[model samples]
Target: MSRFLLSASRLLALLLCAVLLSACVQDLTGPDDPDDPPPPPVRMRTVYDLKVSPRYIDVVGSCDKVFGSPTAGEFQYRVEVNGEGRTNGFESQNYNSRLGVVTGRVAGQQITFAPRTYTWSSMSSPGRIEAVVFGTEWDGAIRDGDMSNRRGARTVPFALGRRPGTVTIGATSECRLVLAYEAEWVQREVPA
Candidate 1:
């Protein structure tokens, strides 16, 4: 009689174990478990379109008309834009150094230059603007208050472009005046 009772108790335990196993299998096929977390949201990246225009001006000396190559001559320049830890440059040909124009003006129609385009990763800060103008340096001797050998190789600097547009700096020479062709970055909307 005791053996029969032990056998019945073992059968009951086996049945309980099977029930728990079956419940677990069903739970996996159903909705997600309470302890599981949902996936994170996806983030999209944004890009911007930027237009870089490096404007330049002809540094015309007062004596250009008297002893220079051309009171109005076509001069070439290599304009470099440096600021905000970024550097970009462009070279222009047949840039008309207009004669008798002592004032700095927009060179869009007057001179032939290449437009620089850039893609801005972000608009955090548009760095400080400085341009290093490289062209024929003027090496002239003053005789009778007039300059000779007006055309030469020279490197000039425009301290900074605080704002967008034309900026001028003093040539720091008695005979020559400084003119700057300024360059800047223009922010534009992304194309559709």
Candidate 2:
């Protein structure tokens, strides 16, 4: 009986030491310490269409005199959007007409514009796309580093908010430009 008890005690002690060793190994091989990952992608939608007709009531001369070009013989509308570091152009028109269409994602939430203190310009010309709200019943213009254009095609930079929520970005040029956008958020796990 004494010999049997001695063997049992030794076995229990061995098991306890094994359990402690296993825990120590796990702590050493755990997940790496790093910054938190980015949030998931969200669904966006255009709830209100920023369609507004230009009255051309506030500018000097005729609507053509203020907005249209004598050489082109038509109004030039240049549209540009800042895609962070990359600027994407929608389309340009050379006739006296309304602005282009801006659509959001499938679902809805307003777009957030994170204002950055820097100058953004077009690669093709010296003209730059200024960060100003358009679509109002007012005339937008160019000043210094600011950009403005009539109904002409152009490329400009735009900023998007870091999180999924209501974001409103003003028109890039000087004119009556209005844009409405909305978005829906979804959780996604980005791979490390």
Candidate 3:
């Protein structure tokens, strides 16, 4: 009888220990427990379609005849805003192939673009000319699903050379141009 009592006590002790352990675990990991781990951060992405227009502010040096005045034109762009508010996208216009990759940031109602540089070589009358284009100062604001007050500038500096090592002093020219961009929102998307 004493051995039977001992066995029953051991079983009861083990059952009580299991119950206490389960209760502790429930307190720590239950759905309603304050100590429960938070759910994965909600990720939200936004996409905007816009039509951008460019206008010339200034043209200088020999570029006036080469590039002429800025023509009235519009380009389409698809901009994606990530969860962290970083913007990345591409120009959907076929004529905009010359424009390089587009990257920027959007905060609240304000948008800005990162500076970009492009380099290429072309044949001039004398020889091959290397052109470096620098674009900067792009800023804009978003309002009522449209973008306004957008402005930017670009500089093109060229060096003309007859041979790999031969450069002509008078053949080089630098052009500065300013651009104003107006964007009309075509569409907006937010993933479910």
Candidate 4:
């Protein structure tokens, strides 16, 4: 008829330009169907399991949080205490009943002081403190210049908070694991 109406008007303008170019080619990208790669970076350090009983097996203690590790650096976080369970003389610093055992590093974890404090010896040697929380109740751990007690087990010598009426000692049973740190970078809070 006019070459079949000009080939049906060029097939209706190529189907109306492929329906307006698929309506302006919209996809914006959302479902490529193959995504599962993001989760692998753990082991700087983060431990917390403080279980206390304290009725006195020579009283044990604990505090928590080692996560991602970063108290400052050089070596932050390492406070290990063990109140002689098998009694090799627990935390044996030559195990002399640890001579007036004291470990009080206030704010970051490590509280227990008394390296010999007596008004004049009425016979009072009681020391065990752990509870002063305004925002941070840490005892110790964030070392660099060798704070000693390098895991051979035997770390108790801090003092900052606790010494009045002091009564956290046993009649409670046992539980101690005080170790703290929060400086920054190198366990870098792990999120890369």
Candidate 5:
């Protein structure tokens, strides 16, 4: 009986110690400190639109407001005859450009939002909004205001153009349309 009591007491003591140790360690993933002001809100937005149908579209870009500094990126695009181009011009001029456009947040190196595919909701934190910019990056040109060649920069009044003809366009830009005092930029959290 005494041995049994001793063993039981030892087990109880071990259990108590384990409980106490676990309690001492708190969960680290709760809300941030209220005192710590949230990180600045960074968002990507479209300021203007470029229409390309006549083969020589014009682009004019500028940000009405700038919150912080951002880097400028570049993209490469191509022009085809309604998805009809020879990759090797010698053979058929079948070219595929994949239309590259380097985008970044309005200013920060890191982006707070990304593109989402939802039917009814609006775009969330994504940088470049997709609108039939109507131009190929080849003939497409951003004139006047020259953004820096540095990565992770932002440029206002980005004006780019493309040659006109049956044109369809999509984009993922990095410029943001956020005020300086926002936090945790959000886009369609979920895509449809």
Candidate 6:
């Protein structure tokens, strides 16, 4: 009977020690200190639809033979914009077919598409051929839920050539397409 009491007392003492130790521990994910600054509010995404019309199209270099002159035309596309604090970005599928997702930053009311580079390589019997495309500048603005007389340009410099033996042959050319556009607020989308 005495041994049983001693065992029970030992178990009780162990549990008390555990409880006291747990109380001394601090929660790592607790709320921030009262003196610390509050977190910034989350920014919502916005979408806009625009009708872009080509005002001018210019092709330079010997590669003009490959890409003929394009006539002025208008096309409709959508743009999705996401903003974080001071930095913001927008994505558009109609920007470039070769690029899956185009990202751009927002400054005031203007949005600019970031430059990008694309490369392609192919193996042939005699040698290998490589092609590189460089993305230029594109930007516009929105005011009062509408964009009017927004001007932007898309410049692509393409280089294609073949490396045969120790010599390389290729053609380099650039296409500059300038556009003016008007956009309307289609709708706002918040992530689920």
Highest-TM-score candidate: 1
* TM-score, one value per model: 0.38, 0.22, 0.17, 0.17, 0.23, 0.22
Can you write out model 5's per-residue Cα lDDT over 110-185, one digit (the tens) per residue? 2122222112123232223221221222223442122221112111112333321222222233322211111122
User: Per-residue alpha-carbon lDDT of model 3 for 92-143, expressed as tens digits?
Assistant: 3331233423223221112234432222212121222222112221222111
Residue 64 of model 3, lDDT score? 19
Model 5 — which ten-residue stretch has the worst lDDT?
A: 83-92
* lDDT for each residue of candidate 1 in 85-168, tens digit (9 for 90 to 100): 677765543322322112222222233455554333444344444545444322232221332212222222222233344433
State model 6's lDDT: 0.30
Write down the lDDT that model 3 would get.
0.30
Please report the TM-score between candidate 4 and the true structure: 0.17
Off by over 4 Å in 4: 1-15, 18-20, 23-48, 56-192
What lDDT does candidate 2 reach at residue 136? 19
Q: Write the per-residue lDDT of candidate 6 for residues 43-148, one digit (tens) a residue.
A: 6554332212211122221112224553221211222211211212223454433333433322112223443222221211112221211223222221111111
3-39: candidate 4 lDDT, tens digit per residue: 9999999999999999999999868786665777767
Give candidate 6's error at residue 182 in angstroms. 14
Assess each prediction's global lDDT (C-alpha) against the native: 0.41, 0.30, 0.30, 0.29, 0.29, 0.30
Find the number of clashing residue pairs for candidate 6.
0
For model 3 the local lDDT of residue 130 reads: 25
Q: Write the per-residue lDDT of candidate 2 for residues 1-192, one digit (tens) a residue.
A: 989999999999999999998887866567765676667766543221111111111111111122344111112323233433545333323212335332221112222233322333222222333222221121222111221332222222222322211112223323223332222122222323
* Candidate achieving higher TM-score, 3 or 4: 3
> Candidate 3: lDDT of 57?
23
Q: In order, how many clashes per candidate?
A: 8, 27, 0, 39, 32, 0
On lDDT, the candidate that comes out on top is 1
